[model samples]
Target: MKKLKIGLLINPVAGLGGSVALKGSDGENIQQQAIQLGATPQAEEKALRALQHVVDYKNKVEFYTVSGQMGEHICQKLQFSHSIVHTTSGKTSASDTEHAINEFENIDLDIIVFAGGDGTARNVTKALNKDIPVLGIPAGCKIHSGVYSVTPSAAGKLLQKLLTGEMLSVSYADVMDIDESSFRQGIVKTKRYGELPVPMDLTYIQAVKQGGIEHDELVLADICADILENMEDDTLYLIGSGATTKSLMDELQLDSTLLGIDAVYQENLIGKDLTALQIEELVADYPKTKLIVSPIGGQGHLFGRGNQQLSAKTLAAIGKNNTIVVSTKSKLKALQGRPLIIDVLDQNVAKSYKGLIKITTGYHDSVLYSITD
Candidate 1:
């Protein structure tokens, strides 16, 4: 059996800004701010989970990695056969990431698996000296890029398939990043830095986040009106980020955290840009809270894209039946027949989401949509 040689890279500070509601962890200042706000780095832990899924295939796989948290530590912990091709100490930056990829150029590897967000994806594309397949572990805030697997475990599943000699198709996925400055101000402006070859299996890999919004004012208003009419007294509404959900916030005459989770009670804005812990606390108090979320455009992900604040614990407390999904008809149509994706890290919670889900398209228009893990 031929061994599948893999390259691993982990960005230590990749997701430092996520749970703190900083939008992204792109700059040093933002990283410190997120830390000060009590945001914990999850890049290494997330990468560990991805690697755990492939530990059984260690005999069939070999790894080339950078020293320290970048890759070496995780490889050592997993007891995988690996060679440290690059070394780094102290704080790492995009330069370190690029330099590591430059080292990978010297080794003929089957795939380069990285743990970071879109910013890391950009660095990988910028430093690639060859057409090697890449996969992302989604350890960052803004994961709008298509190069990422839906979840860390999903990335492992893909590696497991590759090790078992499964013929997975490869395709060029766009490497996308957003301006952190604008993103902090609730404006989502994504720019395509470049593309990278990624193994394709919609069941595992995700699609690039679709930009732009529905311009049909009537449709948006109708959808918002329906959601407003259904708002019950004493009910705490946890509004998920998106244009559609923001429309509801606008209709309620509330300040919307356009890119962050917000809390509404009796149509009043109470909490803005809430973190996962904050959401859980709020749910514990209210007990009658409903989660309103919209599927990301084009990607059709109702969870695990940009809304990390809705952690598994928060979801379990809110209950699946208490959640409401809203989307424009055009957005759903653009998906063709693809079901909405559920990429939440917790398989138990994600599993409960299988089967058909109803989406509110307008004031009286609704459609049943299927969701997949």
Candidate 2:
């Protein structure tokens, strides 16, 4: 196999700004406090997890990294030979990230792989856009960009396919960046720019985004508020897509996987991106869990659109009685009543979801979207 000259960059403090994080930025004294409070710097973990995607290809490829955390330490641990992006300092920060991204702009490497969140992707967009094909290992909290994989291991699995030529055509996606300082104060703001190179056709990965909601997002907000009024403490609401799911997540003052399946009861996510075994484990103990999913605006199908999160195991685990699909009249009308697909990892599990399901639209209201062979 031809060795690919892959570039690697790790944003050591990417996940520092999450809600539980005392310091949203690793540069802040808040990071130390968060560590004391038992929170790991998830950026490094995300970077390492992304690195794990290439573990099997260790002998077939080499990597180039920046100094310190962005470079040798991570590369050494992964045991992949690599080059270093010459940095002015021994350590790296957001500035170093920009520098490293800029450095790779003209390099002839096969692909540049970085472990970070939207911020890192945003910086790369500002620096270059020549199909310099890049992949992201999500290490930050608000991963609203389309460039990230569903999980660290999924990123690795995708890379494995790419390396073995098992993947499909690559595409460019928009990048987004959010102001961390303001978000912590309950004000979320995001802006988007044009497309950048990213692997496409991976049902399990993302490349599109929903930045800070503007007037365009309000319609969905109204829908979620309606869902919230009926969501009691016992109901395990599974909010899917459309304006409705986003609305519920925003009003609940809680987070949703947005595009992924979240096993939510009252207000907590019992499991996220839950696998078959994990769903079985959760239902084994708490069988009251229900599913919340919505079909895409135009596409009639529900299961296959970037929602690999609600695996057959999860749907069967939640059962049809507890399964709830949320969509507006306009969205459902657009579907033209096509049967939704239930593609997942396990065909046997998908069979258990056979039956009629209810979709809640508003108070004392619902419509039926059925499952068929």
Candidate 3:
């Protein structure tokens, strides 16, 4: 086993409070709207969770993190030692994250780990590309990029594998981001930058961008409808819209959240409005709870964005083993050769969901179709 030296960086406040409770990230405009929504900063808590996962492997890896959100106190909490960048104070800032990446330039390390959304990925890329392998423990609300694993636990598992030499350590994960403000209006626009490496055992996360054209949604309607019909009763369905899932909701005579996760069961509207708690409550009663959702049109997100309402709690409660995706052949073709991406709050659930996912649509003469990645 090649015990590799590692560094840790966390964007503590990256995607703390999103649409569910807080208004979410402030856009080109200031974060005023987010502030007004009684939005509290969740970066510390989120970063803490992501860091906890990293610290689990403390005996095997050394830490080279900046202070504060970048890697200060959290490392201390786990009783792990760390190295700080010379130019930086023990204090960390957004610029500190920039500093952390640059500092990696002078240091010799095997891999780097960080916690944040797509914005953090873009920042890290400015410093390390394939030259240094990095892994993300999902912490941000809008983690629409491919550089992260499905969840934090999965990240821990992958890291453990790398340290133990159980898995090959040569490959890359996609680099991507999302538009924070536009995401609030129920839009998730993403773009690809490049790739980073890690062992391939983990579920590869991808970045989801904004939908391309609204005009083609009508064509997607029938496709969404067929998947809706395929949904079993009493199962928890987390539907996404790009015309496909929305049209499916229209056909079921049920109104999809359109931009959130709406719950349906047993021919009854169980929860018109849902949050992570409500979803957990519903799924607990039905152990067989299944999540029926779809990828964003052009961005091709298997989760997040159009389904942020599904929160990590809900995804965990429903279990990724029970999750489902729906997409049209045309939509799948648009992805080129790239696989779909889904970034949610829960790190463990994200990791459990790997391998080819089965998509549900309709049949002949119907917008129904089946697509997989």
Candidate 4:
């Protein structure tokens, strides 16, 4: 078989703002602020994790990437032979990502694998316009896009299957994004930017986020009713994002951060749109705490997609047993046999959550779901 040619690109500052609670690293100002806030670049490390899975195929693949932080640094560290097709500055920008995509389009690559979030996905979509197949490594704060693999290692494994012709088809996946300003204000205004041609393997690639699920209101009400009935006095509850969990806050007649983390204590809102530090502080203050989270509609991710405010430290402090997973039965059925995934960026914390966990689906109903790292 002929060697597969792959184009790789990394947005070095993709996920810098996530842990700092900046919401996203979209503009230069946010990037600078995130760095000042002690946020470190994570895209390169995530890209390395994805690449590590494909290391055995080094001799069977031809690699092309940009110079320096864009891609060369990681490729060199992994000792992978790749030609530098483009050069970028120490600090890259959206234009650099677009330029790199354009360069990749001309390389006759079998696939272009990128490491970043929704913004990076949008840039690639705008550049290629669905002319080439691309995959994401999920290294950003906002990953509403469906082009990303379920995990970094999953990306590598999927690419290996694609190269070997095990995965033979592609499907168009939505590239979604929301305004950062509005997002920080606890408002979720997601827009469908475009679509990218992605591999159709559901085991590896995530489906586009499903909207218009308001029809599940009755079920959501039941779930909230259960949570409300179980509320304990003098205990802190960390409410996570998503419409389902927001229903719980709605039932309590409290304001909800639709896409951010909020804290409720003694049936009252204590904090809204909190940062990781703020959450840790709250956890320290209220040792009796429980985290109420709802998984992404089709992805089955209880954390690490949009709610970076709930950092690994916060989850560890909350304890796995203290975490409550809420979802509609239809949502769980959509998984089609995939385990609920956890990507806290801390392997120890993620691995700590093994075996089956309970998910509250209705007022008096629950299901045992397997948790995976």
Q: Pick the candidate with the highest lDDT.
A: 1
Tens digits of per-residue lDDT for model 3, 61-173 = 67787766567666778887677763356433557777778887677888888877777787787766448778876666656566776555456666767766675546666
Task: Give, for candidate 3, the lowest lDDT window spanning 10 residues.
Answer: 364-373
Task: Tell me the RMSD of model 2 versus the true structure.
Answer: 8.2
- Which one is best on TM-score? 1
lDDT of 3 at 172: 69
lDDT of 4: 0.85
* Candidate 2: residue pairs that collide: 16-24, 17-24, 53-156, 146-206, 146-207, 220-243, 224-248, 238-292
Tell me the deviation in Å of residue 210 in model 3. Answer: 10
Residue lDDT tens for model 4, 1-373:
5888889999999988887778899999999998887777879988988898878887888789988988999889988879988887666788888898888877888889999999899889889843678889999887789899988878988988866668458888899988889878766678999888887788888877766445677898899989999999978999978788888899999987787788998888989878888888899988599999988887888778778778788888888999999988889898887899887668888988866999999998999999886
Please list the residue runs of candidate 3 whose C-alpha ends up more than 4 Å from where it truly belongs after superposition. Answer: 1-3, 17-57, 86-93, 127-130, 166-174, 181-189, 192-243, 249-258, 261-292, 295-306, 312-360, 363-373
lDDT of 2 by residue, 1-373 (tens): 6787788888876665342322144454755655454444556655676667788888878887887777667888888888887564764566777788777766787777777777777777776646688777766655667777655656777778777777567787667665666654445566775567777655546534443323435455555665666567875555553345656666767665443444578787665543334445666676466666775554344563334334455566676666667766666665455555453334466566656677665554677777532
Root mean square deviation (Cα) for candidate 3? 6.5
Superposed on all Cα atoms, the candidates' RMSDs to the truth, in angstroms, are: 1.9, 8.2, 6.5, 2.2
Clashing pairs in 4: none
Task: List the candidates ranked by TM-score, beginning with the highest.
Answer: 1, 4, 3, 2
lDDT (C-alpha) at residue 291 in model 2: 64
Sort every candidate by lDDT, greatest first: 1, 4, 2, 3
